[model samples]
Target chain A: QTAATPAPAETWLPTLQVDTPQQGFDLAIVMARRAVKTTQPDVAVLKAQRPHYAGDAARLIDVSGVAAAWFATIAAANGYWRD
Target chain B: QTAATPAPAETWLPTLQVDTPQQGFDLAIVMARRAVKTTQPDVAVLKAQRPHYAGDAARLIDVSGVAAAWFATIAAANGYWRD
Candidate 1:
């Protein structure tokens, strides 16, 4: 007999009610901010261009750092991460 | 002499004004919705479980379809597509 897999909260968190409505909303907001940040480019890496915000170091985002941050936030928020 | 690369609007769209405030807000809302959807699991695939949403098909999102949809939206919104 084959053992069936169980539906853990980790797998279906988007609609699983893993968090309360307020908590979910808050998490969604936090995730949204990260997603927006992911779409930004790194100013230093693309520095050859006409630097629009040349002196503003705060506006850049390193592309390579995004995937790590994205998955980290998701896993951390959902309690799927291990120490 | 090495040719320097230019930062096109496509590269810096996250912080750059690729879209207007209203447009960006709308896009962000749209993107946020998609990101939330990405976190949802497909009901059909995970149907062996208790099926919290057994009768409802509308609540599900196919995982495979997400990447295509995601890139398409980003590319379309940013005018990166050539077709």
Candidate 2:
């Protein structure tokens, strides 16, 4: 019973000229993925790419919120978690 | 019997001075996560970041190779996937 969070696109969207909410979300996700691939070509995560960009977000992922979800598993598996 | 793959640490490790394979792996993963976070702060993946850089790679992920894994899911969800 809550509202969906407004992404950065909502506030400055008119300036950037993004059309819809789904468009903004899509744009953000692609940018994130590209960031990882272009920056680190040797990481294990890259080793598992499915080519079509339809991968899952991991059922076991979620470290309080989305901000930490991306790094939680790797840090714990690497034994770098401190709490 | 099977042999584990040799990470970058094993090759030409004398000059760059990466201590061990584990260290190399850790270094690579960290670099990947940092690249994504720093480059795409507004992205949802960043929102899901756990600060420790240990997030799961996603179960339903795998695009034949690592290159495509990074952008696979969002592309499909965004209706950008073709094959």
Candidate 3:
């Protein structure tokens, strides 16, 4: 039986739930209700934030890019990256 | 004094640390060591899990897309989304 291992990094991130079974992609469940309720949201600013409100939308496109690099190194060590 | 507000969504996602000032984009800091140390990483499987590491990298592209739609709605209610 699989040992009761420590919670994964994703588990630590309560907001972002990685639902591989359902959507297959990681799900980032944000708490907008709390944020809107207390801090007060700015429609104009938030709206203006746009698809890539933070900056270059492309930057966020590849969540696994940085991670893939590390994954490759791991593959090489364990002899997985080879074709 | 400012109110001691509850932690934001990002705060909950300990894995993905958002560094706005540093890179101007949200930083998704995953724990590779823990993932690697345990379960024994499969270089092939992990490497094959490249680009998207799931399916289409494009899906992960717009982290703010889904969030933006909701953000704008709030803007309308509180008058933040309007141009």
Candidate 4:
């Protein structure tokens, strides 16, 4: 028998069911948290990182800016502010 | 002059204007890329990280799952798949 062709990478990506902007934001937060967990895996290391962050107001602002941008975009997609 | 009170942290976050799901997704991608850029900063370090990722299929799958979830949520928020 001939070798089977490999599936495209996109085909392997699962389609998640989401019905609302709130759900989208929730999923986004989950993904963001998972990413952080994966990257740092150690709570003690995360705690150590916090002290560096405490001194970096600019980084905090940058993070807040990104969060606000994400929130506004999600709001626009919902067509209104969603509870 | 009297001492000033500190403003709430949320007040410093900028509100980005986005009018569509496409805009939301685009901004998300920008934010994701920027996060990566900020974290690594050095191109050579990023390149080094690539080899480790290359051998990690599970991580790749996790990343794709997050992307698919985000896309489905965005589609739902838009009320349909959007171009």
Q: Positional deviation of B49 in candidate 3, in angstroms? A: 39
Candidate 2 lDDT, tens digit per residue, B8-81?
44232133223332233333344445555568867766656543232233422211122233223222232331
Residues A2-83, candidate 1: write the lDDT tens digits: 3576554343234423333234334544554445545755645445542422221211112112222343343345443111
lDDT of 1 by residue, B8-71 (tens): 3232122212344445445434443333333323433333332432243432333223333433
Report the TM-score measured on chain A for model 1. 0.28
True contacts kept of each: 0.00, 0.01, 0.04, 0.00
Stretches of candidate 2 off by over 4 Å are: A1-16, A42-83, B1-83
Give the per-residue lDDT digits (tens) of candidate 4, residues B1-83.
33596655443215344445445444444454455767888989877886354334333334433433454455555453333
Lowest lDDT 10-residue stretch of candidate 4 chain B: B54-63
Residue lDDT tens for model 4, A1-83: 33597654332112223567677576445444444444445666556555454467764554444344344444454454444
lDDT of each: 0.35, 0.35, 0.30, 0.47
Top lDDT model: 4
By summed lDDT, which 10 consecutive residues of candidate 1 chain B come out lowest? B9-18
Query: What's the lDDT for residue B41 in model 4?
Result: 84
TM-score of each: 0.19, 0.24, 0.19, 0.35
Ordered by TM-score, highest first, the candidates read: 4, 2, 1, 3
Residues A1-83, candidate 2: write the lDDT tens digits: 23676553222111211345444444444433433443444566555444323343442232112223323222322234233
> What is the TM-score of candidate 4?
0.35
- Report how far off residue B24 is in candidate 1 (Å): 0.8
